[model samples]
Target: MVGAFHGHAHNRRCQLDWHPMYIDGTGHMEGEGCEHVFSASNKLARSTRHASVFHRHQTIEEHFAFWDTDKYAALSNFLRNHYREALTSIHTLTAELSVYPRLEWELAREADNQALTTIPVGDLNQISAALSQARIRVDSAYAKLQNAEALTAHVEMQLQVEERWAIGDDTYNKYKQETSLCRYCVALDELECLVVMHLFELSKLSLSGTGYKLRQQIGKALQRRSEAIQNALSCYNVQAAALDPPRPSLS
Candidate 1:
């Protein structure tokens, strides 16, 4: 059988580009200068190894499942969703936070602007009341910010988080700086937007009731973001478990 198996393999290899035809073991084989002898049986016995003769293919994908990619992408997208106005918030809040330790002053600036922008004399008292609310919300926002900062620090420290989130950079170093900066910036925006939104809601209650809904959403999204991270981590852990090396059993 082993001899017949090799013979059949040899015949198949020889006839790869030609029509395959064969007769009883006594006949001449097809193609030019190809002749091989073999026993009749086509089965192999368990005593011998057949792999030494047959070649196979290997690729990086064959070794690693790609589930971690979706985990990172989903969380990154969740992170982005949590801070939709990150760019605008960064522009207004970075210096504000550095100098003021919170967004109360930015709200004050907006309050001042509100007085100037209105055609009729607006209630300076309403603006003042919103400023007070803004101060409270700012404190609430930074509390959430601390949680987000800790999560960001943890997510950034994971093994392939930065690598998976090259996020559109041209190199690994770029990946590191860009992901960290953008993530932290977005986190700051998420926090500051919370206060700005509260201020807007309180100050503009008479004008636009729903104008600050996005801020409301960001504030609520703290739970969503935390759940998203846990969900992603769960997926990563499952994939990792599949590839963990076997452990030696106690004797």
Candidate 2:
């Protein structure tokens, strides 16, 4: 199988035929060589070079045992994060592809129209294009409004409010709870994305052969990301606290 780095430069056919991710049973392996392991093990050479054969073997064994244990501890978290990432990618791609059919139909119609006659472009065409864009924006805004209204109506119905909804009333409290839950969920999603991105950036910094300048840049980027993560966490906590049964705050 092609290594993860080189696979990207290959043609689509080569990738499909040789990339580890595309190949069955490869699972999440990147198809890269053991360069990272070799680099890490190189650190042990300074201590092992003068040691006895027995001590060298023991040290190597101990090192790898610790490595394995650490990896095992993190395995579940790694799998869960990757699974979420895969699902997010799939969902995003599916949403993007949803437009393909309408686009194809539009293309087909245009082709048929062109085949019938060559149309001239003029002010009328520009007006029609502008109008189409305006219409699309209006439709999008209307959809958002409808969604908001539906959510409000659903909350109201669920609370079964017959009297005036005043502050501190049960109906008002339930409405706030619903809104708070939605905000909390949104904040949690944002926090997860930020954390995943921060970890991914940190991992890149750990890779062997990273230049000093690149490492410094990554350090600066991480500092900014840390601030962002803190802000997101604060937002999450605020939303969580607004819940009827307040959630425990994260550190």
Candidate 3:
């Protein structure tokens, strides 16, 4: 690509003065012709170097050259702008995860209290039923938190994938091919695997620290209900004994 561009540039410079002469049906002049050829060759060489910059993996150096070459400034600006967008996405994902921990903490505290409740004095069956209901509710909340965390992790992964795509043609083609398994694919596969691992870690952290806290609260609520049921059963057992009719003089 570089060589092609250079040749094109050289051709353009050479043709500049020669074009008019050819159109006018005049032969080339001596001094003026030689100077035009020399200038055109230099311009061509510069253009070739500019085009080659994009193919180089040394982004920093290429970037510097890109800025230096007015002809290629537009391409450089495009890459820089896209990369900025990728950075913005990463920031947004981080902000979203920040709020999850607080919710988890509140849930955990509630669970802890439920786990410590005393049994009530009433219908044992009714108390037991209530406790069971409470347990169900706790489980539901835990499930919901898990799902939310999973969704957040998925979004984070997608953002990372987009970021990788922004880096270069390798990423672009990897995404484009979708199945070729080239070096870029291998790299992306590794990255995706790492992202999944991170997601798992995030889930664990949230569940263990925040979600777990909420679960603790829910567990406490269920425990309190169970105690209430046990008390009711005890009362019923006592009443049954007292209500027993005087046994007909046992033979």
Candidate 4:
């Protein structure tokens, strides 16, 4: 009796794309171009090898898994998340610190203007007391702004540490190879450039304020010069009239 394997073989036949062959005991075949019997078997083996090679090439994740442990990748991922959180917090704190100082400056300017402009007909002691109280309040606000600036500095230092750790030399090189560029370094560089630009703008604003103050001082000097010129011209006119000859009486 034929077994199940024999029945399965009996059912198999050459497909439309395959050539059939019959071989004798002397190893000579008579069929459509079946010159060597082992060639078909060799082709089948080669096809299997090619399939395995293709599958191996396609499984890039598996290839990397064989060489790289997942723990390092996991740690890098965690560090990236933490670094993002820290950076965002630091940015917010920095913005607050920058704005707070400007606010205090505005308040101080307003207080000074009010103190200079307000006129009191009453006792001088009352006016002095009110001005002193206002100055104290402005000083307290300025101190608070200073404290915020210090806190922002501390946060910035912490952010710098984390940024360095996250994108160290080794990590930066590895990221360049893995992702074709160091995204963290790019982001940090962009932020640093922006901060520098902001600093430049702040410097320009300071210079502008100083220029305005200088302009006011120059205007006061010009007013004083105009008054001196008028006084000198009046004195010259009086001296010239006193020295004038009495030519009209002879005519």
> For each candidate, what TM-score against the reference?
0.18, 0.35, 0.20, 0.20
Q: Rate the local accuracy (lDDT) of all candidates.
A: 0.46, 0.78, 0.51, 0.50
Superior by TM-score: candidate 1 or candidate 2: 2
lDDT ranking of the models = 2, 3, 4, 1
- Clash counts per candidate, in order, are 1, 0, 17, 0
Q: TM-score: which candidate is best?
A: 2
Residue 66 displacement (Å), model 2: 49
Question: Per-residue alpha-carbon lDDT of model 3 for 1-251, expressed as tens digits?
Answer: 11222333455434332333322323122224445445544544423533456554354455446545754657778678767876885676565547457567557545544644544458988789769867886897898799788777777686664443464588665564543334333444544554454454445444544566555654564566455545544444443333323112111
What is the C-alpha RMSD, rounded to one decimal, of candidate 3?
Answer: 36.7
- Candidate 2 vs 4: which has more TM-score: 2
Best by lDDT: 2
lDDT value, residue 51 of candidate 2? 76
Model 3 has an lDDT value of 0.51
Error of 4 at 90 (Å): 11
Relative to the unseen true structure, what is the C-alpha lDDT of residue 191 in candidate 4, on a scale of 0 to 100? Answer: 44
Name model 4 segments beyond 4 Å from true.
Answer: 1-94, 97-109, 119-124, 159-251
At residue 80, give the lDDT of candidate 1.
80
